[model samples]
Target: MNTQSDIKLTDQLERDLIERELGTQRLGFVNDAKRVIAAVQNVFTRLQAEARKAKVVYANG
Candidate 1:
């Protein structure tokens, strides 16, 4: 039995947690773009390594 107030509180709590995790400084769009790009690159590199280990080949033909 969730009320509107409860829903609002839950949303606020989730937002707070995200802000805390990312930090206020990193929350700005300009400040986080570089971090986001680096994170994506890191993930891509890891996935590429996994593909190599699994012998999943890709050709740019």
Candidate 2:
């Protein structure tokens, strides 16, 4: 089993490898993708906040 610190280190290594593979030329595209991901995450957070305010309960079908 991986420890929390070990998992974080592995994730960092993977991100470093991907950045190296993408290189400077594609950095702009990577930045754009990051921005889009951030935007989606923000939307999800807002939705969760709204659901909590409305006392929503999630059910599995």
Candidate 3:
């Protein structure tokens, strides 16, 4: 009879190790998302500036 009914050492150790691995993967994903957001913002800012300049040219001509 296994007396440790829901508290096996192997199970608990495996869960703890897997949880740490997942946490590290999640941190990498967050860093990647931030880098993508910054790149998109830069593109939009440049487009806006060009549009403004074209608008001024049209108004003058």
lDDT of each: 0.83, 0.87, 0.93
RMSD of each: 13.1, 17.7, 3.3
Residues 1-61 of candidate 3: C-alpha lDDT, one tens digit per residue: 3758556876898999999999999999999999999999999999999999999999998
Candidate 1 off by > 4 Å:
1-28, 56-61
Instruction: Give the candidate number with the greatest TM-score.
Output: 3
Q: Can you write out model 1's per-residue Cα lDDT over 1-61, one digit (the tens) per residue?
A: 5798899999999999988877866667656898899999999999999988677444432
How should the candidates be ordered by TM-score, best one leading?
3, 2, 1
Highest-lDDT candidate: 3
C-alpha lDDT (0 to 100) for residue 44 of candidate 3: 100
Clashes of 2: 0
With a 3 Å backbone cut-off (N, CA, C), the pairs that clash in candidate 3 are none
Clashing residue pairs in candidate 1 (N, C-alpha, C atoms within 3 angstroms): none
Q: How well does each candidate superpose onto the true structure, as a TM-score?
A: 0.42, 0.51, 0.66
Q: TM-score of the candidate numbered 1?
A: 0.42
* Tens-place lDDT digits, model 2, residues 1-61: 5698899999999999988887975987889999999999999999999888667454432
